[model samples]
Target: MGFEDLEPIFGEPKVEWDQGQDSVKLRPFLFHVSASDPSHLRIHVTDFHSNTWEAVKSVVQLEDMRDNIGIGGSWSEFVDYVIASIKSEDLKLVMEGHSSSGGAAYAKLVGQKLKGMPLISIPLTKLLDAAASEAMANLSLELFKAFKNMQHSLVEEQEQTFQLTKVISAEKERNETIQSQLDYYSKRQKFQKKNATDKADVSSTPMSNGLQNSPDKLKAQEASSTKVVNRVVPAYRRAKVRGAFLQDAEDAKDS
Candidate 1:
């Protein structure tokens, strides 16, 4: 009729620890506190089950259940109470249940959003199967399957790594080729610039020398032209004088 009667068939509830209020606790472990005065509250401790003991334990932990209980048959209200209780932030739910409590405890750890820990369930049924299976039984084939899968994964990872290595090596070779080409181009540019400058200097030197020589050549040509003009002017003056004298003699003879 009661848990005591059922204890023989089902294992007794496991005992959990309480670190007190204001400390962080995980899920499934409920603590109740009651207050002697309206301003104060008392503490009750138990699991989160609907058992009679849990009901009594809740009251002992809290002054009243009015603030913690849900409206009749209201799933939403019950969930709200549970969520509000956790939000108190001052209360902690210790994880301490075993077997039947395992599911509840694991849920609390996960539901309360505990960090750095995950729930692990090792069912007794599975444990028995694993223990009783023959060494060569097909029942344990899952191990072989997992091993083969792991091997495949390793092969894939190795292939990916090799591909990455080849890609990196190719990139390095390309960079080297580009660098060599750049260097070659830079050297060629410098050489071409020097060659062009040298050609310009050689061409300019001859043109400048020719330009300088042109003034002297012009002076020599001008001097030769002046000498010829002077000689021609003297000869023309002598011819004029001879013609005038001949005219004067003819006039005298006519007179």
Candidate 2:
């Protein structure tokens, strides 16, 4: 409850302790006692004052007290609990510290002391190790998440690329098919046109020749008929006269 209560158990502190005012330097530790609501007992395992970061000129401040030996409001209860924890003359206080619950730093204050020794030690190495482990864990988690995201994105990109390639290939195939069709159509059209031209030429050749030959045949027929008419009519009349003359000539001959 007060400094008086602590004096009996811990003896006169290495440094004089004031109630609710400041800390008491107890050898290698600094003891903080709070009398207000949410009363706490903070024991430093390191010399925080000596390790204070330099602020302005002559203004130094302790960045991290990091001194946690024993905590909680009931000192008597913890004292009794620690006493009861002694099994077979072995003063073992194996407390598993939790720094993650309530989203706050380590809640349990941890410190050490040897048997029959007035000195309490706050191992800075252990706390720093814990802090480092926490930091590393968080960093590892962040890195893992980042890598996972990258991997996911890479996979997605690959899938998209594959899909795009497939689409391109399909389009290419389609274009090729269309091009082939066009070529086929072009060749067919050319062949059709050539065939049509050839057919037209063949048909026109017969038509032209027949037209030329028809006029020649018609003129030949007219000439032959006219010549025959002229020769044959004269010959017919001569035949009649020549028959009479022949008859006269025959009679003359006979005479």
Candidate 3:
């Protein structure tokens, strides 16, 4: 809750505007005090930032020229006063906050200590009760809205987490496939190196050693030729060649 949040507690409070400052009128709050007598009470919205706690105040209007009165606190506290007045059966007890501070208190007490006076208690009591109920309703709505927003956030978070897990699993599978391919290629390279080295050594040997004209030598050469014709590439080398052929085919398709 911030500064504007005070509206629920204080109704709608506005900064006091000085008439001398501008002719335009903007009124949301008002406060006054009366002190025609010592027994009387009063309150006012003074330089609040500089002042200290004081008494309830009520301003004197023309009709009530009858002196001596009391007032205090701002209208924000008025509802409490009204409620208290109704409950305690005494208006003077809750005169601090109201539209007209001392007026509200005097209106409640006038008939009690004076004759031929009418009591105006019903209206104030009803107004205060209605205001309190409205404030409660507003608070409940705010809470419900907050709960809905929190639920939405939780659902969104769960969806995001599920998506992340799918991505991670896909990457794991891709890495495993790449590792398998690397192992296959590595074995093929080793087989190719060994075969090439053995062929080179055979080629460097003397072909005509004197035994070349012998019948056994002729048989050996014939066997050797047959072996070469029947020789098969290692499984690793065959697989490597097949992979290369497939890659080439894919590249051709793209072109």
lDDT of 3 by residue, 5-87 (tens): 12111111233222243333333322222233533332222212221112332323311322222324553343334323322
Taken over the whole model, the C-alpha lDDT of each candidate is: 0.41, 0.40, 0.41
lDDT of candidate model 2 versus the reference: 0.40
Report the Cα lDDT for residue 144, model 2.
65
Off by over 4 Å in 1: 1-131, 134-140, 206-255
Residue 164 lDDT, candidate 2, scale 0-100: 100
* The best candidate in terms of TM-score: 2
* TM-score, prediction 2: 0.35
Q: For residues 151-232, could you state the per-residue lDDT of candidate 1 as single tens digits?
A: 9999999999999999999999999999999999999999999999999888777665686589887798789998988875
What tens digits encode model 2's per-residue C-alpha lDDT throughout 163-247? 9999999999999999999999999999999999998887767665676579787898799999988874555555453444344
By summed lDDT, which 10 consecutive residues of candidate 3 come out lowest? 102-111
TM-score of each: 0.33, 0.35, 0.33
Lowest-scoring 10 consecutive residues by lDDT in candidate 2? 52-61
For model 2, the stretches where C-alpha displacement exceeds 4 angstroms are: 1-127, 206-255
